[model samples]
Target: MTSPRFVIIGAGLAGAKTAESLRAKGFNGQVTIVGDEEQLPYERPPLSKDYLVGNAARDSLYVHDAEWYSDQRVELRTGIRATRIDRTSRRVELSDGAGLGYDKLLLATGASPRLLPDTAGVHYLRRIEDSDRLKRLFTTAASLIVVGGGWIGLEAAAAARQAGLAATVVEALELPLLPALGRDVATVFADLHRQHGVDLRLGIQVEHVGNDGQGTRVRLADGSVLEADAVVAGIGAVPNTGLAEACGLRVDNGVVVDANLRTSDPDIFAAGDVASVYHPLLGRHLRVEHWASALKQPAAAAASMLDKDEAYDELPYFYTDQYDLGMEFLGTIDGHDRVVFRGDLPGREFIAFWLKNNRVRAGMNVNIWDVTGPIKALIRAGRPVHPDRLADPGIPLDQVATA
Candidate 1:
């Protein structure tokens, strides 16, 4: 009998980690990674912050050095796209007319940045190439018009501000990050940017955009025009599930997977932004698009592929940085009743805890360091906490949580 060969599609963090996990678990089978991008798998969060600000070197972005791949004996097929998956034959067809057979398949195709209607000089920050282009643009571009108030948009605006370029942020909602962070918490970010001289326009939509003599012209729904040297749309991202959908796999928002990260077909699995996986803690299908999920899911998925009966049940976590503000959020904000503050909100150094039924459902640390462990503990404890103790900075979270 021969060992099964594992073939993974997409060469991002999830895909790279999948190969490493498979080997770490003592899987002596062949491992291959196929990716459309030419470069090796690399970290993405820094692309918006350090890389954009010219503080990090390009080599620092990669998940591993060139020698590691060869040392691990993992075959990397770069600059090649996987066109289709033939389930019955258990093989994947690539754009280069090559087909690779696999006993098990993992899809970590990730996601693509959502784009607006065609407009000249409009950019999106997603890939290394996108960052490289924007880096060049920032060298001489005087002003930037950023659409959407999401993390990416805010991060881009922060980078632009750091570069001494004028930045204007346009959000359709009443406040920035309204959908994700809610009103009370989003206000913190809104104030952070405004304090740094960001021209934030809220409660408006971009009706049309076109090239103008100034560089780019944007028309708002309320009949106003704003000109800038460049325009960037960080609205959102669409999961790359074309191959999964075309192959008759169950896809709802993303490739639907069970607790074990197995797709509709038992032989196929998915992770990262492309998978809507069942989370035991949440008791629901959650698709997280953060670097944390991408870095964590692959190990669980790889273990499951080897019939270890493991589950990817970790709580979803994400972090962001803007100007001087840095934040780390743990768990989901769904069904949270009210937010309780532990420190000084005015001082911009506090921890926000979202409570439901007097129990902590989620919590975020803004500009606070060395407190994530306690925050996660409180969330997992799931015991009712006194509001006064939770709000009082003198009462440590460890004491407030009922262990």
Candidate 2:
């Protein structure tokens, strides 16, 4: 019997994990991983937080050691980008004009950062090289003007504060992180930074960036200008879906995939940020950009590729290391109808629960991750809970949970 030939794209956490899962699932076929980045499949979460502070070194970024790849008998190709896919031939064309035929192909190309157009000294961090460049400039910069109050912007701002750089965050919206977290919850985080000496600029629009030779100047709609040693934009990211689009497959904001993470073509599949996957749990096509989602979704995609007796309906969860707090959140937040609080906001030890018709829809705990199991089960079962009991922090979360 002939073995299966598997080809995976974009060797980030998603691509790397899928290859490992293939081997873990007992498939010993020829697995080829093609990636654009020169470095091994590394974790991107640390690049913005610990990596900038000198706590996390480059060596620690690798998701799997070199030996693991060799042991798994996986063909790893780094520093190579896939140009297009020829679905008719079941082949992927590389930048250098070479082609690799595959019985199954997984698209895990993540996302690219959005930068301010035609602006000099404008930087966006998404790769290892971006981290290195930012770190060098951070050492000399005294003040920084950060555009965009999203996760990347705020995280980088936190790192700048640690490096003794005076940082100012400008958000066009009423509050930073508005679309992700509710406005009320965002206030607590805003206060956390303001107390830590960060200048929070909210509800203002940056018209343009005009340079005056010595440093960069950010012009605002209110006729106010902020001069700083450096200007960093942490705006947002667009998924890399061009490859999938060129192949004449279904492409929306991201590559559209079914519940099992399979693309329109049964032979092709997609995971990671580039995939607008149908999530059974949420009952919607969600494109999550979290690191945890990228790592876990790939395995599910691979499982379906191999025709495993399983479904890829995973509970969505993500967290961020902002300031000194470890913010952990679980379940979906969009469909949630009601919200319950377990603790006080000013106290810094609290959990916010999003309830959907009496059931816990989503929950977020600051510096708390131990009780995630019960919250996860409740969301899966769509169980209901009393408002009073859910609001009391004195009652343990696991007590209300059933097997």
Candidate 3:
């Protein structure tokens, strides 16, 4: 039997890992990867943290070097955008006037930063080039005005602090990271920046941004104006689902997919931030921007394509380094009303567990040593931990699940 041709849209983690999973499953079919970026699939998590701090090199951020793709026999079509998806003919049209035929398709187009059009002085930190340009600004600028209190914004603020630049962050929301994190956990970040000398302005919106040769002026809705050498934006992201929507695929919140990660059209599948996959545990479709979700979902989609039945049931985990502190979030946080913490808050370390009905549903750890196995077990076994034992650092967090 001839191996089927597989065309994957997006060369990010989802598209790249799907190809790797295909070869790992012993399917030797034609795999062509289409991406708009010039570089091959590389890790994005570090782009705002270590990469932005100038600690990690560009080559190191790549999951696989040139050798891995060559060995896996994956054809890379970088610097090409999939303009249209002809589900009727099972082909994708590229901007460069090339069309690729496929028996199966995977949409991993991912997400793009929310950037204001033609904004004179503000920049968004989304890709390598975006950070590279920001880094240049970092070297010359004396002060930085960051808009938004999201992860990207907070992370950049941390980087700006590390660079010894006078950094000021303006968040429209009441608290930084209030959308994703509960107030209790968000406070940790709010404190982290303030303690590090970040001029945090919360509950403020940018009314107008005007720039001159000397610096940029950011006028706030609260009748205040702040000037700085440059402005960096850390507003969230919007899923790149336009092509999928144009293809007549259902795109409610994102590219809707069943529990099996199959799109409305069975021949075409979608994953990553662009995919709104049904979560059986959550009892609804969820779009997780976490790295683990992006890495795990595409494997299930590929397995389903190769006639392997696997329900992508792994937990989600994402880690971020803000200055010298390391923070990690695991499991699902929805429907969690109660949270219990492990370790002291003043000792510059702690872990917050999101509990629903006395069982751990999600968690966030700050500076806790070797917490991976414990967080996974807490989610897996539905562990119920005591509040007192959790608050004591001597209690060894990894053993909490067993205790």
Candidate 4:
């Protein structure tokens, strides 16, 4: 009898962790990871944070040591792209004219950065090379103009400021992170960047981006002109769902999967940024593009592939470090009626809870540490609490749930 073969597409954090989980769970089956990049699987958070600012080393981005794959018997195929998924024969065709048969397959294809209409000279901070290029550009460039005011744009702007480059952020919305954190908490971030000498152009759109004789030229919708030594578009990302869509898998905002991370096909699964997983707790399909999903979703995906019947119920979580503010946001702010604040909001040390029907739906800890457990507990408990007690610093987070 032959051992079952497991093939994972996209050798990223999710893929690496899935392979690791399979080995840790006593699965001696054949495991193969396929990636388009020549380099080994690596994490991406530092690309815009410590890495862009030269605080972190290049080696720190890798998910594992080079020898780990060879030791674990996991076939790591770099510089190979999975072009086609033949569901009938249970085989995957590669870009290099190779096919691999698999008993089970996992799609960790992740996402690609959404590019602007004209990206000729624009820098995007998605890959390691992009980060490296931007870091080098920071030293030579005197000014940078970031085309979006989202997390990526803001972080890139912060990195430029830290590197002594004049940075400007242009956003179409009224405030940065307004859709994600709402205006109440989003105001804090706007102030933080302004305080750090970032020129924020909010409620404006970029009409055209082109290079002039001197440098990059940006024209805003309001007929304003801005020029900078370099430009970066940190607008957003779209899931890599072409393979899934072509193979007849359900693809909505991303590859649709159940609570177990199982796709439409029983033998195929998806995790990480590409998987629009059905959250049992939230009762909706959520496609998160943060590092937390890539870091943690693999365990449940591996379990499902092994037919263990485990479900991935972890809430959507993400964190960001910009200037002096470090924040961890757990849960979703989809349908929250109001945001309750605890601790000192002015001092940037507080926990903000998104409440629906007075029940804690989501929470964010800004410059506050060691409160994730209690916040998660409160969100899971689904109990109503008095707004006064929930906003009081004197009351412990655990006790506030009952109050």
TM-scores for every candidate against the unseen true structure: 0.98, 0.95, 0.94, 0.99
> Best candidate, lDDT-wise?
4
Candidate 1 segments whose C-alpha is farther than 4 A from its true place: 401-403
lDDT of 3: 0.85
lDDT of 4 by residue, 1-403 (tens): 9999999999999999999999988899999999999889999999999999999998999999889999999999999999999999999999999999999999999999999998888999888999999999998999999999999999999999999999999999999999889989999999999999999999999999998657999999989899999999999999999999999999999999999999999999999999999999989999999899988899999999989988999988999999999999999888789999998998999999999999998999999998999999999999988888999989877777554
**Residue 72, model 3: Cα distance from true site in angstroms:** 1.5
Better of 1 and 2 by TM-score: 1
The clash numbers for all candidates, in the given order, read: 0, 0, 0, 0
- For candidate 4, give the lDDT: 0.94
lDDT of each: 0.93, 0.86, 0.85, 0.94
Q: By descending lDDT, how would the candidates be arranged?
A: 4, 1, 2, 3
Per-residue accuracy of model 1 over 103-176 as CA lDDT, tens digit each = 99999999999988765678999999999988888999999999999999999999999999999999999999
Using TM-score, give the best candidate's number: 4
**Model 2: per-residue lDDT, tens digit, 1-403?**
7788999999999999999888889888999999999999999998889998778889899999888899999988999999989999999999877999999999999999886874787878899888888898888889988999998898899999999999999999989987777766777778877987889999998999877768999998899999998888988999999999999989998999998889999999999888898877777898888888888987788798798745567777788887787888887777666777788777777888887778888888887668788777767877668777877878777555433
Model 2 lDDT vs. the true structure? 0.86
Rank candidates by TM-score, best first: 4, 1, 2, 3
**Weakest ten-residue segment in model 2 by summed lDDT:** 394-403
